[model samples]
Target: MAGISKSFFKAEPGQLVESDGELFKITHLMSISSVLAVNIKTNESVRLHVENLVPISPTEVTEKKYEERLHPDLALFSDDEWAEAQRRFQAIKPLLQNPIRTREDAETIATKHKIHPATLYKWLKLYQDAGHVSSLVPTKRGRKTGTKLLASEQEKIIESAIEDIYLSKQRHKPQDVIEEVLRRSRLAKIPPPHPNTVRNRLAVLSPANTLRRRGFKEAARNKYAPILGQFPGADYPFSVVQIDHTEADIILVDEAHRKPIGRPWLTLAIDVYSRMIAGIYITFEKPSATSVGMCLAQAICPKREYLAEVEVGGEWSVWGVMGTVHTDNAKEFRGTVLERACEEYFIDLQWRPVMLPHFGGHVERLMGTMANEIRKLPGTTFSNPTQRKGYDSEGMSALTIKEFERHIVEFIVNVYHQRVHSQIGMSPKQKWELGVLGDANSSGTGVMPIPADPLRIRLDFMPFFERSVQQYGIQIDGISYYDKVLDPYINAADPDNPKAKRSFLIRRDPRDISKVYFLDPVDQRYVPLPYRNIGYPAMSAWELREVQQTLKTQGMRNVDEHMIFEALDRMRVRIEEAKQKTKAARRQQTRIPLPKLPVVVFSKIHSPADKSMNQNERNFGMAEDDPFAQPIKPFDEISIIR
Candidate 1:
């Protein structure tokens, strides 16, 4: 009200007032024009008045900017850090004297806290609107404005540079490229450009269908340009895991052929909170749910203790639901399967706009790093290595496929991870552990104008019991659950009452009719696989184990209490026997079975009688014991032995 007019339509929010001697010029109005109270000093004693008024002119108005309350050095943050502080701020705001209402208020809060205005706004919005807070921070100021140098010019320069480099197959200096550009411009009647100008132009133009840090950006130039992405220290895991898919070349051995397969798909997820890779999926094809599923499973699955023994500082200490997930707007991702999965997992799929991939730069970078470094293994091929011009998938040159692949995989899992990550300068595994242990928030949802936490994810978020479906209202084990239950929860029962059926919705697997996963409210985790699903659950594992003990107590072990289980037990035993008998020791196994040879005999023929008693006798006399003469002959075929 200091500067604004009383009329609702005439006044603007934050209109500053300037004062002249005879008259007053409205400076600025507070955000809410109706909520102004003025304290005026006619003499020395000031009186407070709640009235419709406008801000006075220059004489009364002064340019006032209080020193941004120096934040606790600990509280100060880069633009990325503001989101988290804001989240904490929202939860703690009720404890503060003022509630946020305007951009100025948010800025003021950021000033006081030594953070970004976007951060404060995100925090305050959650508090005022939904009464819940999110962890995502606002984007940093230095983001790509898309205010790039002219594209046609950029292309012309690149073409000029590449033409020379490709023809010579050598690296060209910046000066050389600039000279070529100038020379061409002169011939073409275009303006001559500076060398630095050409390099700056190149930095802005990232390659199509690829993610690469612009190495040409001179560090000193445009320091205020948007930074890509950042994460606070290992505060929490899964706050905002970024999922993305890109084609990369990884040497995969085809076990069938004992040779390298085609280029592989790289599906990767990075924790925005920790700036760490929570999961990695590498395959030799366009990435699919099968690929994503593997990566996601790794991320959500509990980290085992043996990790510490295998790798240093591998221990993970915390686990739970992440606040939100960021992904690209790919058709496969928009389908019902992924949407339903996120709903069931209590995860929000925050898909970026189509073709606007820089929004997910972190994961994209990880992909580039894995490919660029690992693919350039000793024997790995590139389309234009010396010139850095283009990509060539099938190599014209032959490399030892086996040796190349072995080194590549080994390098990724061990050597690359051991090296410093680009964003945080920490190993991916190390950052990942930090997130899992700390329950920090990392979400873009926090940046929404309104609070997002209180938005109870809709019931239609796949696999929940809907009130419209009756068949969904069946009992499982001892509890009554459904796909959707009627408003009355007609089949619902008291959880405390043993005779009653406790009601809930179920998520049946579309791929397999044999499996159904129940949402267990106790641990906030999914059911371990192979858990039996009854219409009404009889009891938890602890309860079931006790019942088994009781059955032993009653001496009913021989009797088939559950025929279903009894049949399973019998089947299992049979399978085990078959496996044991058919399986033979490696050394004892025969290559092929042999058949016995049939025996056959033929008549013998006798040789003509001859005598060898005398050296030159007219005829050799028939002799029974003559050494030089053939006394008898045996003919025809005979089976040798066996």
Candidate 2:
């Protein structure tokens, strides 16, 4: 009797052990270790040198019972079984003849007939729900088919449905699953649950009553698990954290604004390890340190605690001190005053290595995710101004640019940090918690802090320059800068010379730091300069380009001799016009008032319904001077139809 079960479904796990019945045919079997369990079925852990291994069902307690109801041909019940079924049906004819109108009536009749009334009632419900009107209807059915399930059961069903649909699953409808469960339970003489109960459970599970896919393809993902770790920031509420600039959109006046308030560059910061945003500030401008300062102030500066998790009167901080601050070589980040502040806090200034910009790639990715996630919140609006300004780091309000940011941070601290990450089956918060558990506190080797200098912070930011066609030396802020090594360029222009004209793009190097190099064409050679000490100095290429464009537009330069001749000729013409105007003025005497213009009126003139106007004629033009205008004589107007 091994490897045999499922003739009747045993609902309770323990009950399955007692039912010694067999149903499914193992036609496709070689040697089954375990049904649906890949690991045990493969037997990979312990390799056996046996020529044959047999699959034996040691415990026949499974709910996934199969049926031969599936058919390639319209097969029916066998001759004897059908004949016996007909005989049993005829024997039970009187119960059908006098239909019991109520459960009580059925029970009374059932007691007399020695039949289980509950069984008869269930069959009736099953028949009714399936449009058969028999006695097997589930217990949870009446008017509300889908709404009969309990809340927890509803949620479970919805979640299960979503997962199944995502896999393009078939075979089990909610009703079908319910019917099978009932069949199994009743087969073992256990009371079956109602269809309404199952339906109600599904309703509480999801009101939408539909399945949606998260749209991730496991096959396309890299064949490696995600590497996960943590980088802890401050400990107090928001004591000190690094603010990185990014842009995100959100809804404001909705219809008036059409889409969300866009062009709003999002400035936000996160606690390194918890991945929580300390604060956020958004504006319609280039992201700056000042904005970063504002966002940080909102986060670090304690205003109030609406509902305190910890005690009051203390600085609101989940992150307490600024540590080895990490950032790219952005100008806003490189300010000397900001560096001074960091120094005061004893925070180390760590500029991610040039060219290796993605060293701070985690923050960059976080910023991207912030934008994407908040974009879903775009149709959401706030009730007040401060929230819109992104000034308040925390408060109770409908989601605003600011409120949404806070929500984002909370999600990070609560959900993202707590759950096992998709990449690594460990949380960022868990990692940090582990680190802290490793060491309660440090000695004199305190956590690293940033450098703070108020006047102007000095950050070793990446720098480069763009190639220039020297027009009387590159002038920056009206002070002329000379590439005095013009001789090198001249010498290289001669075909006989072995040097490529050393033209270079003088822009901030997205990579490389310390020195500026005037690299030659094709980079055959480079003229390095000790720019930090001396040699070359000019504003950023972005600034210089703006100035240069302004000067060009204002006509600061022209073809010298050609403009001079043109100017002389223009001056003579101006003199002649002045004399003519003077003469005309001398002869002028009286003034006359201007005449008024005739008013224009646009009034609709509906034509008589001879269907005079074609749809094109009605919409195409005005009364006069219309290109598509056709002259219709009063004598001839006709109507046509197809």
Query: How displaced is residue 508 in candidate 1, in Å?
Result: 8.1
Per-residue lDDT tens digits for candidate 1, residues 309-422, read 123232332223455677776765665545544533436667665577787777777777766775565324443466333544333223333344334345545665566777
Instruction: List model 2 lDDT by residue over 359-451, tens digit each.
Output: 666567777676666645544223346555753222212343335545555555556557675543566554443433324553121111111
Cα lDDT over the full model 1: 0.41
Give the distance in Å from residue 263's predicted Cα in candidate 2 to where it truly belongs. Answer: 3.7
Query: Which ten contiguous residues of candidate 2 have the minimum total lDDT?
Result: 1-10
Stretches of candidate 1 off by over 4 Å are: 1-237, 305-320, 343-346, 377-413, 425-642
lDDT score of residue 188 within candidate 2: 53
Candidate 2: segments with Cα more than 4 A from true spot:
1-243, 249-260, 273-279, 298-317, 379-403, 422-425, 436-642
**C-alpha root-mean-square deviation, each candidate:** 34.3, 37.8
Error of 1 at 121 (Å): 25
